[model samples]
Target: MNCQTLLIDDAPAVRLQGAAGDTVTVLLRGAQVISWVDASGVERLYCSPASPLKGPQAVRGGVPVIFPQFAARGSLMRHGWARMRGWTLQPWDTSAPEPSVSLQLHNAVGDDPQWPHACVCTLTVSLLPNGLRMALTVENTGPASFSFHAALHTYLAVGDVAQTTLAGVLPEGAVLSLREPIDQIFEAVTGPLQLHSPLGLLRLEHAGFGDVVVWNPGPDAGLADLPPLGHTAFACVEAAAVMQPVALAPGAHWQGSQTLLSGL
Candidate 1:
């Protein structure tokens, strides 16, 4: 296992390499996992090249940590402030069998005034053989209770979005194929999901999340952060708890995770 600090577009980032040639790169800006390469050197996550790497803006792709809120459903900023705030890197065990790193956010002070709450959030990314696992834990340290929603907004790389098929615990032989724009939230997702694309087979498993969000903007969405035809190369399959907000009392904590297995 090896770890190195590198800069992407002048922003500080950490790259963790496993002995098997798999690697994961995490950015300090949002504690985002921007890249994941399998042992065969194939990138498994899609990150937009046109997205801004610096500042108060979130990166366009990769696994974005959505916290406190989801979308425009709250009074706070869309997706909350965790994805825009810088996080401090936590020390990890270098002697571990697999490469792993953790980043933490102490949201006690200097957070959004509208959502006043003292909380701590940590994101840990661990590299596996031809796979990656991300875990998010949130702890409330204030005297009052608070409710919030969160998700691991994961963007999966594909050879072509039109040629991809996603399968869950659906009707027999029924799978989702993205040929047009789609933004659907699935509730009570208790089973694993399989994504079959031209690149290969990938499996997604989630824990402590009740919902799964499948999204693709198609070709005409015209997102400023994405290049033209960029929509053809990726799909968003997120593990989320959005419909039901989680309430944590003072001194309470909660955790959720999403794992991705490539070439499976």
Candidate 2:
């Protein structure tokens, strides 16, 4: 395994390469996994070419880290401050078998005053032989207890979103295919899902999360960051905990993870 720091559009980023030839690149801006290529040279994560590489806004694609809030559920911004804040990279043992890296986020004085709660959030990305795994851990460091929602908003690259089918999380034998606008939240989802695309079969599994959000704005959503018809090349399948906000006492911690395996 190998790890290195490099620039992506002049922004700092870390790239980890596995012994098996798979690689994952994470940006320090959002601790976001912006790229994941399998050993066979298949790019599994979708990143918008029009999205700003460095800014207060979150990138349009990749696996974005959403914390302290989800979407417009609270007054703290669309997806909270985690994805917009810069993260500090944590040291890791290079001797470890898996090629993994971790970035840490903590609230500071005079940060977003809307939801002022001291906290520490960590995002770890590990590359597998055929895919990758992402884990998020949040710890309350303030004097008061706080409640929040979090998710790993993962956008998967596909040959054609209209030809993709997702199974296992929905009703038995009821696969989901996207052709139009889709925004559905499934509660208490504890099973793994299978995404069949024109490229191959991608397996998705989640841990420590109860909700799975499937979303797509369709071809005409007119998202500024996405190119024309960009929605048809990817799909969003997020592992989340949003139905009920997690209440953490001072010094308490919570963890959740999402794993994607290709050709499984």
Candidate 3:
């Protein structure tokens, strides 16, 4: 069957009326979300960009485009360039049983100065029977040093912050926030990373990632224009990067995936 867009609104105030081709239904009540549904197939975060307690917008969300250097790229903004520009979209492949869509973004020649490199990035938002999956694939179409980040800065809906205890491969001080930096790291994590939110139990699991960043903008951190992020109803539990940057030689490819599951 040819691909078509469908809008279905179920009970309990679930807004599933968004166009399937335009945006993916990642969030139900704005809070239970998989925001940053860009046409480029990248999903940013709905909560704070950078770690709030760490620094607002430091590296918050919007499919941060990383380049030659991560923290010291000195190119466009933090991370590198990617998310800063508009992306193009087209149908690719969704082999999974559940409905899914794919989008791609490439640097144009006229506007290549920003990145000064030739590369193609594709983000796929696959709606699986169980949950949603976002996959990022970066390919070097030019002859240049290339390495960027494709992360999902997740703001997990929670009840309380202080009472939350996280499990998983996180070290004692792997890092909860940038300001309150810690030097702990866990080798292998199997159970759910627990968070004691006033709301209820919050659990986070890292599937294909090496680092995890947990954040709570707390009362001390100022506010922004993010209405989806209820004052303190969310917690930023992310799959961190900062490892070996993908040094693509030409015609090279790099890919990564991050998944989020939610429940009270």
**Local distance difference test, per candidate?**
0.90, 0.89, 0.46
lDDT of 1: 0.90
TM-score to native of every candidate shown:
0.97, 0.97, 0.62
Collision pairs in model 2: none
Error at 240, model 3, angstroms? 3.1
Which pairs clash (backbone N, Cα, C closer than 3 Å) in model 1? none
Q: Which stretches of candidate 2 lie over 4 Å from their true place?
A: none
lDDT of residue 17 for candidate 1: 91
Tens-place lDDT per residue, model 1, 127-155, is: 98879999999999899999999999999
How does candidate 2 fare on TM-score? Answer: 0.97
Q: TM-score for candidate 3, please give it.
A: 0.62
Return the candidate ranking by lDDT, descending. Answer: 1, 2, 3
Candidate 2, which ten residues in sequence have the lowest lDDT sum? 108-117
**How far is each candidate from the true structure, as Cα RMSD in Å?**
1.3, 1.2, 8.4
Candidate 3: C-alpha lDDT: 0.46
